[model samples]
Target: MPRAAIEANERMNLRVAAQQKATLMRAAALVHADLTEFVTRAALREAEAVIKSAERIEVSERDFLRILELLDNPPPPNEKLRAAIAALPRDR
Candidate 1:
């Protein structure tokens, strides 16, 4: 979501070294945003990127092909799988 579109109703407090605060303030000014807005946007963006990276899967071409082959030619059900399927409700 865009920073301007966020319905901010909570408060967050942060403390930084003087030089760091000055740098943040200058950067915020350069972007025509307040310190809180700039920091919130940056932090949210990074947090989203971290989450997205965690949820993504990267497999080599060989692994991908193996997965596709398994799907296309799945093995027959084992005894346990057959028992589990037999136990399912049959009302449908």
Candidate 2:
């Protein structure tokens, strides 16, 4: 089944050097895509990559093992944690 086309109602404007604009137009023509479509597709691809990289956390194998070990052999809560927990309101 064919999908319905989405309407483009928003606008974004930017200024670039004439050479840069020409280069983008040339690349778009080589790919048989309209200038707006090509630029937006490339921008969106890069944006998604940037967002994924920012949201990802990388841990070393040694640190990961340490985390698992800590979880398995957790320490007893000390005075501060006990006081904080006790300070919470109790139900009637």
Model number with the top lDDT: 1
Off by over 4 Å in 1: 1-9, 75-92
Tens-place lDDT per residue, model 1, 1-92, is 22445547687678899999999999999999999999999999999897788788889999999999999999999999999999999999
Estimate TM-scores for all models. Answer: 0.63, 0.63
For each candidate in the order shown, give its overall lDDT on alpha carbons: 0.91, 0.90
Which residue pairs clash in candidate 1?
none
lDDT of 1: 0.91
Q: Candidate 2, which segments miss by more than 4 Å at Cα?
A: 1-9, 78-92
Each prediction's RMSD over C-alphas, in Å, is 5.7, 7.5
| Weakest 10 consecutive residues of candidate 2 by summed lDDT | 1-10
Estimate the overall C-alpha local distance difference test score of candidate 2.
0.90
